[model samples]
Target: MDNKIIAILCGLLTCFHLSTAFATENGSDSFSLGAEGIMAGALPPAGLYFLGYYQNYHANKFIDGPSQFYVDANAVVPRFVWMTNHNIANGQLGWYVAQPLVDLKVKINGLNDSNQGLGDLYLGTMLGWHHQNHNWLAALETVLGTGDYKTPSQTHLVRANIGKNYDTIRPIFAYSYLNSNGIDLSTKISYSWNSKNEATNYKSGEYFAGDYSLGYRIQPKIKVAVEGYYFKQMKDDKDNGKDIDFKGQVLAIGPAIQYANKNWSLEAKFLKETNVKNRPEGHANWLKLVWAF
Candidate 1:
């Protein structure tokens, strides 16, 4: 394998689900399931909700330092989420659970690795508010993940790993605003902190992510939007207490469409990475269906 490819893999150890950062083989969200857009703060009627989502990510090439390497990496993540109601902090409280199934493949330089299996279990509780008169909604939530799946060894150059191997805390703030004019805006920001991977004794750096959407509702059941997100690492990953100078970042934007009825909602978005460092630059796509019960 080329040294540049090695650097690419090593440089992205923190890319997995965004635990202390979410962890993944490609990256978080696109691994951890964070950074949602469009009506992120909208509160539904008090009841049970179920969501099914799928994402396909393809990045065939990457740049690291002054070297660029060829890669043909693709990942398919299927996720399911369940949320229900309660009351907390004088606001409606909702608790949710998410399970992710991941199929990842990579071909970098002349080496290849693939893995298909269960990822991590994510759970969270949120307090949500909707002011109908003001057309505003807001939510505060804390997400947590269990690291009980596949983890790469410390000496791996490339491996098929589905889990980050560290417990993570992801706290989030979500807001949205809409008016009679059909204009709408939504944003969500989340920060993650991860515990050390005792098996490898590696500590990924903390990270911050922000997602936004601007849209216009053409009708009560149809909408179009522009969606984008930004991610930045706050510090360097550590190996047994040694800083590794491998912070990473990326930005993406694209268009989206959503259709909703009384009981079901469907959404699709396409994002292209506009800028990146020590990471892959390519296209990511999302398809989601949600139903209220």
Candidate 2:
């Protein structure tokens, strides 16, 4: 009986997931939008809810295929998620969207360059589920990236790049568990399927990424946590029938906080990239607000 109880407890406590990865220049991140926890953690009966998400990302250095350079890049993304009271497979269903605005300046090989523009458009569909007692919640989602590639805004002096100019279809799974003793764990996992960039004739490789968090509820309205993410490009990039060889990996970790009540939810998190290869190193900050009726 003791062993069985221990096994059950471990099973209940040790499950997690993450997000997908994509391409970007210095100071730009379409991935790791500070998404943590379970979107399906709790299911609202039947109604409309609003979710507002914001992220500020900056990168100062990076490695591009064996050459390192200095870059000052910043991207701000404002996103919205709409919730519906409808149900599917015992879960709530919804859709969400966003567009990114970017400002980037690079001092590479001794040349100063910069560009600012609206990067890309994003869309997704979601299904969320919550276990009884609010101890566990899970979500499954499909997100699409439009071919935002290089439009006029993407064609700046030096053709400064904000959008990667490719299409992506990624599936995500997220879950969270809170123990009776106030221990909370949440995670998400995703795999990205990528399409070619018609402008550069370059097709970026697909990648996998995830976010994980552990925290303790300190008060009825607040929980403090440590959060992190990891990204890995699974294969080589291709350009015009040739290998571009731009696969890389990234890892980051930091602190996070959440405050919630019956009608509002607010969360903030900061992450610092500590390990990277074949990509830029940077930090990301996120703020999220939600209102429900």
Model 1 scores a C-alpha lDDT of 0.57
Model 2 clash number: 7
Worst 10 contiguous positions by lDDT, candidate 2? 6-15
Query: Best-fitting candidate, measured by TM-score?
Result: 1
Error of 2 at 184 (Å): 2.0
Q: Candidate 2: TM-score?
A: 0.77
Off by over 4 Å in 1: 1-35, 65-85, 133-157
Each model's lDDT comes to 0.57, 0.55
Each model's number of backbone clashes? 15, 7
Give the alpha carbon lDDT tens digit for every residue of 64-178 in model 2: 4323345544555555556577777877776656665666555544444566766656667677666643423233333333422333223242334555655666777666666
